[model samples]
Target: MNILLTGGTGYIGSHTAVALGQSGHEVTLLDNLSNSDTAVIDRIAQIIGKRPSFVHGDVRDTALVRELIKVHSIDAVVHFAGLKAVGESVAHPVDYYANNVQGTVSLLQAMQAESVKSLIFSSSATVYGVPQYLPYDEDHPTRAINPYGRTKLHVEEILHDVAQSDASWRVACLRYFNPVGAHESGLIGESPRGIPNNLMPFIAQVAIGMRSELQVFGDDYPTPDGTGVRDYIHVMDLAEGHVAALDYLNGRPGWSAINLGTGQGYSVLEVMQAFERANGCAIPYAIAPRRSGDLAAYYASAEQAHKLLGWSAKRSLDEMCASTWRYYQTGV
Candidate 1:
């Protein structure tokens, strides 16, 4: 299969590119390098033993996307391009909507023009918002708590509508849980531009002595450890899930949405402890008050994905931490 990936140089996208290449599919990476480094392309080539074709451009550039599709004869598209900082999104809602929602619109239009209809979209569990129920499934209501999440849910709806308008479209919205870990090669990993917004990357920074300490938010949560619990899926497993989704769409002729998660929840303290063990050091930290929109507990059922795409997360938390640590250690 010839797969064109938007934001393919970013963390999850880079990993997915490797997975796609290893699975006997040709990958063409499209990225503007806003939040990621171009060096990741070389690392990806090292991982797969074959360099992928790349186009440096924005997903919002419809003309560029259409040209890439026609020139490469793309068979499918894995759309991972978008701004995804929750707090940042709250501060800049317009920017969030324009990039996450409008960018998706442009990509879809280009796909339609080029007759490249197979698409795998990157959604988030945050679309569930506060979670009216625990263990969110595909059927969970989508009441997004933040602008970032709202953008994702909106795109999911748009994809559904497009598929409905044309039966030739095949779309899968993979609602991802908290994605952590790094490639075992450590050649490419999460590289936030400034202060990290997510936990695992913060832990990695602290472990590498680049930061002072970890700040555990709200230790008084309703969870067992008095901290918020979340489903942290390894980036590699998440990448594999994208490949499976593309394969599933390859055989099918309709659109669907699925959750990509391990169906397991781990609290913040538990993750800190695990990282401590992984890095051979105690991570200093202080318990801080809960932020405005933090959830007490959120995880995915993943049963639908297993049933539909025959995919489930296989990496344990220890593996997640260890692999992430390896990436930071190698400093590649």
Candidate 2:
């Protein structure tokens, strides 16, 4: 299959590109390089032994997307292009809507124009808001707490409307949990511009001595460890989940939503311990006030994804830490 991946140079997209390449599929990476670097394409080529076709553009450029779809004979698309910082989204809601919401509309229109129907959307667990229940499933209600999550929910809603209006389109919305770690090769990983927003990246920076200390948020949560807990899935497994989603979309019909997670939750302190174990050094930390919109604890059921896509996250916390440490060591 000839697959067109939006935001293909970003963290998850880069790993998914490698997974798709290894799965015997032709890949065309479309990226604006807003939050990512072009040198990532070179790293991807080094890992996969074959570089994919690269396009420098935004998903909001409908004509450019249409031309690329027509020229590359793209069989499907995996949409991952968008601004994803939750706190930043609160301050810049319009930018979030424009990039994530309007971007999807443009991409869908271009797909419709080019007659490319299959799509795998990168949705988020944040769309569930605070997680009404532990181990959230596909049926969980969506109530985004922030503008970033609202953008994801909006795109998912748009995909549903498009699917209902057109019978030819096959769409799968993969609601991802906390995606962390890096490829084992240490050639590619996340490179946040400033202070890292996610736990794993921040922990990795601390472990590598790039940062001073970890701040454990809210040591009085309702969890066993008295800190916020989350499901951390390795980037490699998350990458494979995308491949599974694309493969399922290729053969299956209609619209469906699935959760990608390890079905396990870990607290902030537990992650610190895992990183310490992986790095062979103690990570210093202090308890801090909880972030404004953080949930007490939220993982995923993951059963639906296993049954539907034959996929389940398989990496341990140690593996997540070790792989991330390797990437940090080489400065990837």
Candidate 3:
């Protein structure tokens, strides 16, 4: 199948590109290179054995998206083009809505115009804001607290409504948890433009001596280590989940949201320890004030993903740390 991946050069998108390419699918990557680096394309080429067809464009360009679908004969779209920083989203709601929400609308319109329906949206676990229960299932209520999460939830709603309006549409919104680690080859990994927003990358930077020290966000949280706990999934595992979602939507014509995460939750300090053990180096740190709206502990229920898409995270925490260190040692 010919697949189009929006924002295909970014971290998760690049990994998913490799997964899809290895699964015998032709890939066309469309990215504006907003927060991503062009060198990622070469890394993906190294992993997939060739460079994918790339478009230097944005998803908001309806005409370009339509043309790509028509020209590439794109059978499915994995939408990953959007801003993801939570703090930045709070400060710039308009940009978030325009890029994340409105951009999706434009892509959908183009798909509808071309009569192409299969879509896999890159959603987030933040949509299930302030987890009411441990191990959030698909039935959990969605009350996204931040603008970035709201944009994802809003896009999910739009996809649902689109499927409701037409049974011919096959759509799946994959809500991802904390995706860390790098590819086993150490060719591609999370390389945020500036100060990383996520925990694993920040820890990686500090471990590699790129950064001075790691900031432990509030050691006073109600967890085993007195720090925040989270469900961290290996990025390669997350990439394979997308392939499974695509396969599950082959002949099915409906909308479903699935969680792509490991069912285990690890605390902040626990991850630091794991990385230290994996890399054989110390990651210096200091306890700092916790960010507001940060939850103490939350993860996903892998039952639904296994039951629905036949997918589950298969990498260990030690592997996640080891792979990340390998990628960093390459000076990527």
Q: Which model scores highest in TM-score?
A: 3
Q: How well is each residue in 94-153 modelled by candidate 2, as lDDT tens digits? A: 999999999999999999988889999999999999777777888989999999999999
Residue 102 displacement in candidate 2 (angstroms): 0.3
In candidate 2, position 298 carries an lDDT of: 93
Stretches of model 3 off by over 4 angstroms after superposition:
none
Model 1 stretches with alpha carbons more than 4 Å out: none
Clashing pairs in 3: none
What is the C-alpha lDDT profile of model 1 across 1-332, one tens digit per residue? 99999999998999999999999999999998999988889999999999999999999999999999999999999999999999999999999999999999999889989888899999999888888887999888889988999999999999999899988888999999999999888888887889999999899888889999899889888899899999999999999999899889985777788999999999999999998887786788988888988889999999999999899899999999998888888863
Quickly count the clashes in candidate 2: 0
Displacement of the residue 323 alpha carbon in candidate 2, Å: 0.1
lDDT for position 53 in model 3:
91
Please give the CA lDDT of all the candidate structures. 0.91, 0.91, 0.95
**Weakest ten-residue segment in model 2 by summed lDDT:** 246-255
RMSD of each: 0.9, 0.9, 0.7
TM-score winner between candidates 1 and 3 = 3
Against the true structure, whose lDDT is highest? 3
Clashing pairs in 1: 186-327, 219-226
TM-score for model 3? 0.99
